[model samples]
Target: MVREVLTVSERAPWWRAPAAVTAGALPCLAFPAPALWWFAYVALVPWILLLRSAPRGRRAALEGWLGGAGFVFAVHHWLLPSLHVFLFAVAALVGLLWIPWALLVRELLGGTPGPGRAAAALVLVPAGWLLSELARSWQGLGGPWGLLGASQWQVAPALRLASVGGVWLVGLLVVAVNCALVLLITAPAARSAALAGVTGCAVLTGAVWLWAPRPEPVGSLRVALVQPGLVPDSPDSPERRFDLGERLTGTLAGQRPDLVVWGESSVGADLAARPDLTRRLAELSARVGAPLLVNVDARGADRPGIRKSAVLVGPGGPTGERYDKMRLVPFGEYVPARALLGWATSVGKAAEENRVPGSAPVLMDLPGRPGVRLGPLVCFESAFPDMSRHLARGGAALLVDQSATSTFQDSWAPAQHASLSALRAAETGRPVVHATLTGISEVRGPSGGRIGPALSTAASTARVYEVPLARGTTLYVRFGDWPAGAALAALAVYCAAAGARAVRLRRPGPEPSAPPARTVRGSAGRRAR
Candidate 1:
């Protein structure tokens, strides 16, 4: 009797989908709150292992989609309170974006099942992931929030890589490391290749640590960040929020900071129209012996429109220096195709009147501090790298993000939002202050190190940091997104090569060996004839 060998699917286990979901959720631990950074390297191994067992492209695609759903759901789970039941539907739909990723992984890992395919997976898997990340980063889509590299915000060597090549390079290295780990278990036949890949990553990390340029400290600026800790559902009026901020900021008058920053929409009225309110802020600036940077969300008093603006107040009066927020949050600031998606407002926090965006990034002058310039990123603008890069290129000495995570403070949103400052700081080689309404306020140095303790969501207070400034630009600011561009070029080449190989394989091969005479003659009657 002969026994047939079972294919991977013939022995398919029941645990595959759950396994993918679990693997997908594991990486969240690598981010803030739990912040087990080392786990990020190995987090994807389980998914890759599942991919190895996937029988065909279709199966792999399903697994990939499921894993993607898990990741989106886990990372943005904090949105549940606001988004409610709709959050899961949104996550599952967004997970559809990973269908192509599954197909690619299967083609490289599951189809050929050899060293060549294994090697391709190591390079192409991460490339595919980065491309997916880049696509979702579009503002109309959800912006870049939980990027893979941002998990390494606290890692010194990774921050150096960001200084050299922006977050794209760091994310590339992280995915490469994950690929290497996957290879060790999933492709035992390619052990040599896996070892080499891991070694290359280690060597590259060491090189960055040993040689990356250190941020040189120029003069320091004492800046105070105030949090009002207001909740959205509370019965407190908008004016009450302002009063709380005013009270919190008033206490810091004794510290005598060079600048005072309040969270987004701290001033509900347009200061230009409300001269009385502007005067109050100017007096506060005078009392603190510094300029007060306050964010305003209101109908344009001078012009006939609505806007979200960052205004500077000096002892003399309004400094006339302002940065209107350039990038607006898609659903939060404005509903995309309002005629079509206007219904979004019924589901979540959509703007009553879509806030108008600024024309370009503005670098505002710091009153009384000659040669000191501040770049203000309002609310969601902090999530974008180009905004920060643009500000840095415009000769901004300090970068400040005025944010309000009041709605999602109880969720992962505040922690995730606050962590972005470190990446921005590293990329631009400038100090960054994340001032928020509720909490998770932070100050990061040029090298991405925290200047002081971050104010968590539980606090309603003000803290001052003697922020160290840097003189020259980092290579990242000089050459923007070069690493991502290179990765794109490489991906194109890889796809072309893979296409050619598939065509060759599909082409007709030589006929099989000539059949024996008996087989060719078929039956005995035919042979007799």
Candidate 2:
């Protein structure tokens, strides 16, 4: 009887959907590798098979959640230590983030997930995953790490899609391939199964190679990035922060940058309030024979309470292009409903006390490169694709990301932080100079290619790079989330319709409907992508 029950469980349709979703989530493990990225692509077969076998409705949802839980747990385990240190009880509660991810996957792969149905997996799963990543990026809840799209950072073909629709598209296409391969294997009609799978993947590969953005080198502009990691300065004594700025300015003067970038909170207080610091940076700009783009993490004099800002100053005067950060980290920036919830804020940095959201995106003029415009994102902001997309679409020639990773010190955080710039550079089809406090300052060129050296967040240092500036927007900058969002919405519609039909079929009969036997096989083993 036990053997029979085990056999039945193995054959159960409910089991297959979860298995396939789990398999699909595997390809996302290629990042932070000593492991090869190409090997990660095969993790799709299980979900494809399971979805093809699943009964509609709740069974599908369960399959998705289990798969999502496994994937999220495996990918984000790095958070355990950090969360444990700061929010011990809340860190233990992190498992909640995976619930929605699972449900969305099962819905997309519902109703046989065959050729006709499988196409929607491309959209629904990627969109759902993207929304999940965006949702979790809120700081108080948790930091955004190991976004699935980021796994393919080093893969050339996958990176190509980044330029066209951002990293999200690559994710969609990868899921689609898994679905299509599953459909072909269980095609039932005995069609050109292998041929169809091969054709689809080939077309995707061909398109990326054909349309990939090539760099057209413009004149190089030398720039320096200053990182003074983690030392604290109070706004009350504005003079305390000025000396640090003075040292950076004094050192950077010899490098002769077209513009110098100070990492997030390089100026501890608001220059508007400090006044003296502004004059010092302006003087540094004059001494260095360039303009300075500096990040401020403090309250504005006029507004009085916003926590983050970026401003560009020429030797002559302020460029008047200042960007306040729009996305605030939940716990780090402000606690949600602090007066009502009231508890977490009392212990650590008050969530609301940290920072406020910026009102709009701003583009400033570059000093040495007269006609070129600059689009900037402060620390934690560069991780968002839409943020950089907004800048790219707005006709900014280049991208600048200023961050302070001093808190992270010498961990995986710097590598993770640096990776965002590569993906952003790929997405915008423009160069990105990611200047960080402490280190890991990097330059990523137009084709998702990286240049120069990585600085350590544990040490104080500065470096210069000759970056190429690109004009005009790429397809990614234009369409934003529409493609992936459409995929997700279409999946929901398809699953809802399919679920209703299955329910009506099961209502009158006690016995479940059975399908003819089919075996699934494709992308199951480690094969070349």
Name the candidate that leads on lDDT: 1
Candidate 2 lDDT: 0.67
Model 2 C-alpha lDDT per residue in residues 1-529, reported as the tens digit of each score: 6665455556665546446445645754566533345655556566545643555434444455555555655554444444333454443344345445456555545444454444445445555655655566565555555666677777777777777767777766665555555556555432244346557767976887797555566666677777655565455433443466567667766777887887877666777777777777778788888888888877777886766788898776577878888777656666666676546655555453656787888998786677788899987888788888888888777789988665556455677778778888888888888887666778888767887776665656656787777655667877787656665576578669879999998887677779889875568543633
**lDDT to native, each model:** 0.83, 0.67
Clashes of each: 0, 23
> Least accurate stretch of 10 residues (summed lDDT) in model 2?
83-92
* Model 2 ranges with Cα > 4 A deviation: 1-28, 33-36, 43-63, 66-82, 85-145, 178-195, 212-215, 229-245, 346-354, 496-529
Highest-TM-score candidate: 1
